[model samples]
Target: MVLWVFGYGSLIWKAGFRYEERLVGFINGYSRVFYQGSTDHRGTPDYPGRTVTLEPSHGEVCWGVAYKVSGEEDEQIALSYLEVREKQYDTKVYLDFFTDPNTTTPAVSGVMVYIGSPNKKLNPNYLGPASLEEIAEQIINAEGPSGPNRDYIFQLENALLEIGCEDKHVMDLANAVRKTLSEMKMDS
Candidate 1:
């Protein structure tokens, strides 16, 4: 059996796992938003960095990459890695990805997607929704073991653009963060 993983955020650029193949795909009925907070990878508990989450939105589609993990052993290994990397999210199987945006074909079925829940009881770092300015402020001033939160947003935006995908939400947040950083540099 083969395992398929759907990546819409950092996983799109930094998979950190082995995959037999990758395909650019679009998942409908969901929208990506910077609503999840990261305390381990991008920020500390006191100053969590903002991250993307799949929010339910009818008629909305999120473009991302789908990784195919072959063999049972590799699937297990991939799952283990994702469990740690996506500890803040709940894994769900989604079959709405179309490898070709123009067609209704699925590159891989039963694709596992990491979804963030905004329940404080479930995830202490969950920071629901915030304005772009607010998110930029937090991202610019946040850093963790992985690196600066600003880097994450920049990388994701670049990756999406590289794949010929244009996400206004991501671009807007990225632009805001850049503007904030530029102003800070000028002030210093």
Candidate 2:
């Protein structure tokens, strides 16, 4: 049997999936944004702040990468993905062919990754009502096992916008974070 997986946000740039093709794909009924903070990449796992998830129900397009997995290494690939995706996101099995009708990519099937379950422990809204800039700053300024979450957010945003997603909520949140961070600079 063959397995496929889809990546929208960090997965787009990150994922580290092994498969046949890295075709451009899209996932509907969900859009990408810098809403969730990553602990492994952005924060600490003990705090476990790093993660990606859909916010409410927004109808929009999101650019992503799809991979086709097969062979003896398939389970290994999935295990690695599960490790990176962590337990916060749901790991549901999905077909690997069929572009999102709303987004319009080539015909293909793959697994759609999402936050595993709605556990209040998963989301604490710790950063408060900060804007995109503030969030971006935290990501950049804050040290993580990797680098900064800000870079990840910016890259993902760029990827989405480059594909013409233009999610209003994503834009607004990013803008707010930027504004707050900029003001803090003046104050300091």
TM-score of each: 0.96, 0.70
Displacement of residue 64 (Cα, Å) in model 2 is 2.0
RMSD of each: 1.1, 4.0
- CA lDDT of each candidate? 0.89, 0.58
In candidate 2, stretches whose alpha carbon ends up further than 4 angstroms from where it belongs are: 33-37, 45-51, 55-61, 90-106, 121-142
Please count the clashing residue pairs in each candidate, in the order shown.
0, 23
**Residues 40-141 of candidate 2: C-alpha lDDT, one tens digit per residue:** 566765543323565434665555677667776875767676666554454354533345555455466456455433444654433333555555556545
Instruction: Give the Cα error of residue 128 in candidate 1, in Å.
Output: 1.3
Measured by C-alpha RMSD in angstroms, how accurate is candidate 2? 4.0
| Cα-based lDDT at residue 144, candidate 2 | 65
Which sections of candidate 1 miss by over 4 Å?
A: none
lDDT of 1 by residue, 1-188 (tens): 88889999999999998999999988888999998899999998889998999888998899999999999888889999999999988536566568776777776767889988767787666788888899999999999999999999999999999999989999999999999989999999
Error of 2 at 103 (Å): 9.1
Best by TM-score: 1
